[model samples]
Target: MARYGMQYGPPQRSRVPLVLVAVLGLVLIVILAVGGVLLYQRLDEPDSAPPATKPSTADAVEFRRVLKSEQGQCPSPPSDTVVCDANGFRYTVGRVELNGAHVTEVKAAQNEGDPTWHVMLNLNSEGAEAFTRLTTDLAKKQPPLNQIAIVVGDQVVAAPTVQSAIPGGKVQISSNYTKKTAEELARRITG
Candidate 1:
């Protein structure tokens, strides 16, 4: 009771709060130390190397000899990779080049990093002359020379005469090819 007649409330107790504060501080310090260590290790260590490249695609020549159809169709059509008669022939790319204004032979399914599959023709002088004449005719046609197609096994692959005429009867056929396919095309053209 107060002397002035007002009633006084009971005294409030004070709390220490020391142990709670200490525990909280300790936990904070521990978390920070752990975080710093992980960050430092990530930054300091050398980078782990990337995984090596797997041979997802096989060599064109090798694929041709050993290619098989997932569905086992025969006399496979000349598209992408086709297998027929229990054998597979990969239609790889072929390249042609001119040799003294004449085509020599086409280079077939070469591996990556290989020089482009260069094709040269052995067009007899007469053949060379014929090719040149035909090319000129195709160039002058109303439809232009884009229709001039190179046919391989019922497949018309490229029709590129847009740049220049195939001098010496030499031309190139590049595609997703295998060695066997390139060889087969070369054989067919030689005949």
Candidate 2:
């Protein structure tokens, strides 16, 4: 006999409800944590933007080829580096004289009412000298040969021809790039 009443086995409390409560609590905590992280990230940058869509497999392959020839297996300093576009058309551009180290700043800008964006590069003294010479030589070439390709990492973002000497050193690459793409180019060049 029990002290207060008839013994009903043991006070069997169903743990199912407790378990459900605990699981719900855990889920809430996880959601809160994730939300907090996302909020912090957004607040931290304020001007943060989403990343652009990645290039296709063909673009990646072509970019890899360009990087390999431009910076990877070069025997000498700056020579003729032959790179192919996504369409497999090859362009034998001058060697990369001014790399990320030579670039001081990179910015993405767009003219009002213009549907396209462009990347601008501010270079150092050494970069300016080498760039001037490269552009000068390219300008003297024929139609398609006049353009100078900007190879960054495994990507060839732009290839525009030099109209004049470009003596001042600030180079603006006009291209059919989107804002995200322009920002990406800026990141690559300012590495």
**C-alpha TM-scores of all predictions:** 0.34, 0.52
Per-residue C-alpha lDDT of model 2 across residues 1-191, encoded as one tens digit per residue: 43785567788799999999999999999999999999998788634333423222212211111222223343234334665444444556544556655556567777777778887666678878877887687677666666666765543566665566676667777768788887866655554
Q: How close is candidate 2 to the true structure, as a TM-score?
A: 0.52
| CA RMSD per model (angstroms) | 17.7, 11.4
Instruction: Please list the residue runs of candidate 2 whose C-alpha ends up more than 4 Å from where it truly belongs after superposition.
Output: 1-80
Minimal lDDT window, size 10, model 2? 57-66
lDDT of 2 at 109: 73
Residue 89 C-alpha lDDT in model 1: 24
Candidate 1 C-alpha lDDT tens digits along 1-191:
43885557976555558778889999999999999999999998643222212212212111111112133333434444332221322223222211222333334434346543422234546556766765665555443222344433333334444334455644456654455555555554443
